[model samples]
Target: MELSELPSFDFESIIKSAVKKKDTHPVMDLPVDYEEFNLTSEFDRDSITAFVKSGGWAVGGYLEKRGVMYSAPRYADGRNIHMGIDIWAKAGEPVYAVLDGVVAYSTFQNDEGNYGGTLILKHMVEGQEIYALYGHLSKESLELHINGEKKKKGEVVGWLGEESENGNWPTHLHYQLCIEDPGEPDMPGVVAKENLIPARERYPDPRILLGDIY
Candidate 1:
């Protein structure tokens, strides 16, 4: 069956209600089209920086790493845990959108230990207002993003930054998906394992819609 003919579901309602009441500087990745990814090793090249900076790299297959769902960023309420999949890329390299959308929120939320600069875009994917997040960027990028700016897929929004500028980590984009509303522009992306349930439910699995990481 054609993608256009796929049966519909109630996911749209869930997305609409969430958008109506969401959070600060909120806007809210894939790689430059999500060509491929390898998690077994550290991603150093622009093709892989996030993993080298953080603990894990991009998953090579379609699904998230085993046990990641229960993991902090991925676990339901685990704040420190993983929420969205990581895209390992190099610093200073231009970051591009996997699809088109409106810039919901962007800023230099320097309060946290990390996430020096962040950008959030709201895309109407499959008729749902899916929020995409980009964090750990060069200071210059934050100063340039204007709210409500419309960007097309594959457009270069900003470049990755050095470890010092990118929250003291190797240059890479810390991308994530959110539905619960961050409450603020720079709200915590990851949390301790204790808060996993709400985080999971509020931030439903983006993998459900993003197929084939590699």
Candidate 2:
């Protein structure tokens, strides 16, 4: 289906309502200038968790220096342009479906600085097929079902995973949207600087669906 043909979502209302009703942390309200913080600086998992717990989401990794986190050989040119929005919250916090869809993929990545337990849902909006990815989820999230399971909008799909199971990172949701399936339970959450334009075209800013939560 053409991208323009997809149905529009009430992103603002859905997100605002979700935040108000859930025990969400406000990431954008944090006092630190995340953009200027040294992305490559060494940080312990506990310290990172405490930072997010202090309140607000950290921003400014997209197409920037944060690429060090994904420096594996898989990432071309060691590029670190973040492609999704990371929602900071405590481990075990509930993550809900923003729309009705079927479970496309679910599995544990279990790699260093990886998504860990991830869930991908295949959604149909206005007859256009789209996909949503939720990463860093608890291992329990993978036990709930198998591929092709149907889910309803706002259903509790999973909870945040701890540092041990969530790629050794602080508890947070790595939320991303995709126009075309990447053919794996895992999708590229970050891209190379040279691929930024095309990647953006394929993976548009997830914050659109997330509303003002950023």
Candidate 3:
């Protein structure tokens, strides 16, 4: 049987409900201040790295229309709409869990332009099951926990990866929240223009969980 489409979500409501249950932990150990970058086709890895280095820490918004950066030959049909939030900071920066969850997947994707060392945690918000994918992490992160391992809020989950280990891109964290199960360690961080609506339905903005960092 063909799979039915997933239901849409009111992310704002979900975020409020989750936050009301308990306070969240800091995902990265950086200060509350963050410099936001709006990436476009003109921006490349070198330019972006330079920007981050000069500022110390930066963030990329969810669902931003970007090009070239996600233009690798591996991506077919010009998947330029970003589906996750990109947190840019120094390599080896420790990442923590924002809420109670279980380790769903921890694996290193060796393919070029892939997530590389990635982790996905299963969470519950208002009795609704959701998944959080943390990409571009250090290989060591894969060993931080086994499948089904439970993690508490504010607990150290893993650290950011170096460029060499993080999908061959500049060091950063690709954080995404999916209402539907990805069923694996990986999910598309960008989608084709035509899939934007469904993609948005499937992956809500991560900022809802991360709090105000812009």
Best candidate per lDDT, number? 3
Off by over 4 Å in 2: 1-46, 52-68, 71-76
Q: Residues 1-214, candidate 1: write the lDDT tens digits.
A: 3223333435635654554443212111333443345432343444344444443333332122222323222234433345555555556666766567778888775432467678887777446566777888788887667888898866777777676676655455666766534545654455454555555555554443343344
Q: Give per-residue lDDT, candidate 3, residue 3.
A: 14
Please report, as a residue range, the 10-residue window in candidate 1 with the lowest summed lDDT.
22-31
The worst-scoring run of ten residues by lDDT in candidate 3 lies at: 1-10
RMSD of each: 9.0, 7.2, 4.4
Ranking by TM-score: 3, 2, 1
Q: lDDT tens string, model 2, 1-214?
A: 3323334445424443544444333322334444223454454556668876665345433333473466445555676767777766668777888777899999998777789899999876545566888999999988985899998777788888988898878778888888778798987887765666677667755654554442
**Candidate with maximal TM-score:** 3
lDDT of 3 by residue, 1-214 (tens): 1112334467757665677667888789776676777886466788766755565788876777786576566786788778899899878889999899999988998677888789999988877787999999999988888999999999988888887888787778999989878988888899887777778888887877887666
TM-score of every model versus the real structure: 0.61, 0.74, 0.90
Cand. 3 Cα-lDDT? 0.82
TM-score of 3: 0.90
User: How does model 1 fare in lDDT?
Assistant: 0.55
Return the lDDT, model 3, position 146: 95
